[model samples]
Target: MAGVRDPGALTSGQRTVMAATITASALLFSSLTSISVALPVIQRDLGISSSALHWVIVAALLPLCALAVVSGRLGDVLGRRRVFLAGILCFGAGSVVCAIAPDEVLLVAGRGIQGVGVALAVPLALANLTSALPGHRRGWAIGVLSAVTTGVSVVVPPSVAILVHFASWRWLFVAFVPVTVYVFLAGSRHIAESPRAPGASMDVRGCLFIAGGLTLLVFAFERSSDWGFTNRQTLAPLAAGLLLLVAFARAERRATDPLLDLRPLVRSGVSVPLTALAFAQCAVIVVTVYVTLYLQQVLDLGTIETGLLMLPTSVGSVLLGPVVGRLTDRGAGHHLVLGGMTLLTVALLWLAVGVDHRHGALLVPALFLLGLAVPLVYPSAGALSLGALPASARGVAASLQIEARQIGATMGLALMSALFTAVEWDERNARLADPAEHFTADEENKLDTVLTEAEKGQALLARLPPAERRKVHDAADAAFSTALNTTLIAAAGLLFLGVLLALGVFHVPRRGRRRPGP
Candidate 1:
């Protein structure tokens, strides 16, 4: 291993550390979401069967979610710079594997490798920024950093479409090569090692238990879309995963070197801020998922068209981010968070009421507003989550906060899906009951499929009598629209709840000398 080169001097102080860390984190986070937009083309090129598509996308995410805490803990115990560099190396290597893979299996394997890399790097990146920057600038720095992280959600989707169109889909992975290399070389040289607890040791057993449990938990959430929640496939893994997680929590209390300091896990200070941010995150991700669907499936737009429509959100994020950060820096963190989350709540409610087949343009302002809101809430929330922590606790706090966000997004997806399914079922059954319409189980499945894939659906519907076909099509649209509406309302309610929590519960970190002696 490269001995720590004059990293303190290399950083050139906080300004360079801030710039390098933000750039590195953006690339890492963007890589996580970029694959989604390119998946269809990837599916076609790899001859990936429809059944395997989920795995292709989930491959990287699984490790990313599962290993997050473990990576953060390792950073705390060892040195942040060393662990951070190792992550860059792993991410770079994984990108190479992904770019060169010749078949579906190898591609999925490569993705998993990339996920591991992200897990290791992401938590430490923010922790470095927090520890490096001075106190007053901390919130602003974290907010701007959070803005960059959140921008990935708005930016990656549209960007991927353009890249895939002009260049091969492989270039998506290839593109990461130079960026990852630069971060590895420059970040390793510049970023300083964070303060480590003397004689701090890792809880290897606890890490294994947590890692195992998290992997299973993510698997359950990932598979729930395909395998219904009631199915044994979903229930069995979920039950076992929760049990293992419980065991991990118990282990943390007793272990000498706990993966997470158990005190914060139970404290209102940590839980409340984390809970509030998680809900807001849940709201934003659902917007990304369902809004894209409404534009494509409902408005009947193509991939490139949908991509273009979504560009305003990214533009808004880039333009508005620094302002939010500045506001937070001026000790307006709470107000900005409240205002930002309120915008999210309003945007979602607007989406619920206003979205229809003809009004794709209405989405532009709502999405821009959504993008604008993210900076307000997340950076402030991140600052709140980590600001008062001892250097070592910052890693656990950072990773745990990340894990909460991922879990929130997972839960939100499952909640929306269940609600959508229930609403769709009732609406569809009401239509199917008409005696003149005779859709068999097969025909019913085909009709549902058409909502997502219009061209193939239209061909199948042509086999039906023209009069019956139009009713069926319109009913399908109505059912989908209703389900989407209800889901948005639910998302809005969750965000509002987060707003309340942020107002009432998120207090500044308490000062203390709590680290155990060497």
Candidate 2:
């Protein structure tokens, strides 16, 4: 059993080291989600179209997904500490590039560099925590890591939005540079270096296959709107991606030391948990992206106000995470997952029925429940999946888990954005066909700014005759309601699919321990 110790249990030196390391990890995770709040600002300043903006987000995610497995393999073949330090340096340099970027293309390139660094740093950080701590204490440390990384999504984004309101958006990247430097400096002294395994060669072929396949897949999703789902542009990439993935699976089977060992997925216990994890991640991203748009675009809230309205999600996750972690440690993961998914399903259904411009309050409880479900599901899924693998394969298992998450997030964003854009276009056309009885060209232009300034909208309306103003208001409200309802209904279907996958694929049998030997 682990003995009780001070919350600052490490020697002064070790405590500083741990603090620096964990802080850097938290910042990386936070920056990924926090940027959502600044999307409008980015679009305005950069003079980019919506499609181009979507590519900026996808650029960061694509490299993260493509390189995640390769980074883990390199860590195992090289040294975890050395690769981790390299990742930190690359990440800091990328931040500098992002801060000074002159155009959208350069910014996307900088973000791609940052993604490479993130792919390396994140998994190694988790693996390092496991190595530094022992037994049950390891579980607690992992819980703390999860809480920091996940909780930052709620805390950091809003704080950054406040900065955007007061200062320039470039300051967001500038703020991260100092922290990254501190982590690199402190990590040099405290973290023990893992020795490279002898005779382990990098799987170049396997890396190419997986990276090529995933790139094609994500590109297909990103361009599906413009290309049309059935057009040659879309079908060609989708088909090529599927073929390359098939080739990757075959190559992995024959490689002496594969980049991604497929053998683990063949095991019932490991496969089950991984499947559940993928679906859960997909559900979370779908809801988050749409809700953020709904709040800002449809309801006409400011960045800070939208972030504040999202507080219920952050609060629920922080409060319930530890209790769920304890339950998972006690071997109650299956039931916990079941309950969590059920709650998520209910929340999505509620949003489907109740979300609207006038009924903003109705969304709070549903968002809270959805947030509570995430922490409960995520850590438990991770623990169960890792538990099914041998101790030697822990690093690869961790990499695969993170890869699944990135893939889910990429797919969710791509799909939901397509849906929302389609709905928006349809509503825009409908309104144009029969301009609101009182709407003038001036009011129509003002409606575009409603996302940025609701007060301006009210002033514009006040200048019109009372009956005409009412007509304009009614039209805006109807459009918002129609778009929001369409998105929510889609979310409900996705969540229900997640629940079904969880029940069928992740249901562990009563008396059997997870199969060992990947």
Candidate 3:
């Protein structure tokens, strides 16, 4: 091998290296979905308030959003393999702490640690993958990684549901212990060292500015629903974050070796795909959260069944993984992205209409199409992201791409939350305005307020007559469906925008395209 900096000079077997990296990648991705299944169990066991329980989820997300860019850059300076190993160590340690924590506070704190580890590892793994594999194989490798994650999501929930049903939420953390340990030990041997900038000075000020800015920015987005948008608590942090980010941009332009170089983002190859992926990801995340709610709350499906009902989401990744990857390898990355976005937009619109119409069958097919479309976008986009950067800058490229998607996820969740609250308020207000419903003043007052999950559950409706209970149930479900549909429509629009951006990203002429040989 010529040197460590040469990506074409990976020293280990590709399969073994990919196994290790993808295992670490899968571990982080699985954590995102499986935890939701155990949240209710955790709340009951820890005696945490319903409203406060959101902090547990936010605690994890906050660090992932805040530290992602810095961590990626750190990998470039320090070494991707070194960062990956350290991340696994942190993640394993955090899981143990989470498993043993006696209260919600400690558990949430443990998750914050885990999130830091995740922020460190995820991008480095992809960077390593894009580096180790040949250009043609990179897309296929990304496809396999995507499929592995989808497979993990499919397996984790029902299994966690069963574990939570029979045992404690603590066991959920225990499940990952052996697997992570195996990955760490084996990965030490298989993963190769990547190109790194040992002489580049760390951008400490840039790091601080970005970390503070993104943290506050995400904080403001999360709190905006509770505190009005115009509230000082919301607006002050947001404005300050914007200013810090502006300063950060200026600092990047002036830095000797910048934390984040803005120049790579100018190319259509990089800018278009990454930007489009962000909105596409926004649609997926919002849909997943709402659909899970729809299945459990609207359809009253049990935990295991709800998990099963959502299983079709994996099929797309399985089927599209090879095709999209090959297409990307063949210089059709942008074209595939356009197709994926179109599919997702249709899926979102389908779900919106079917959900509002209260037809359960339609949701299944829509989710299937979503499964198909999502994999197409990811592999193509991830390949393009790596293509946009030099081997030394892969870490930065991967992290920035993930960070864009992270921002999209945050914004999507916030938008849906606000929309749901508003629609629920309208539902409640309608009862006060209705004369024929004949709800008493006390009943109308209670109905006029936005209801919590517990308030909407069996206890509240138990005392009502059968007819009144049925009416209440129907109204609640209808209001939820309408709100969800509105969110879906908005998500569809986001995907449509993505389609346009993706087309621009892949604007190369077919005749000029270069293809790898057998």
* Per-residue accuracy of model 3 over 86-166 as CA lDDT, tens digit each: 888888888898999998789988888888888888778888777777787888888788778878877877787778777
Model 3: weakest 10-residue lDDT segment is 444-453
Q: Give the runs in model 2 whose Cα sits over 4 Å from its true position.
A: 1-13, 128-144, 188-193, 356-358, 387-396, 434-484, 505-508, 511-518
Evaluated against the true structure, the overall lDDT of model 1 is 0.71
Compared with the true structure, all predictions reach lDDT values of: 0.71, 0.71, 0.72
Question: What is the lDDT for 369 in model 2?
Answer: 84
**How does each model score on TM-score?**
0.75, 0.84, 0.78
Candidate 3 TM-score, true structure as reference: 0.78
Q: What C-alpha lDDT, on a 0 to 100 scale, does residue 45 get in candidate 3? A: 61
**Could you tell me the TM-score of candidate 1?**
0.75
Q: Rank the candidates by lDDT, best first.
A: 3, 2, 1
Superposed Cα deviation of residue 273, candidate 3 (Å)? 1.1
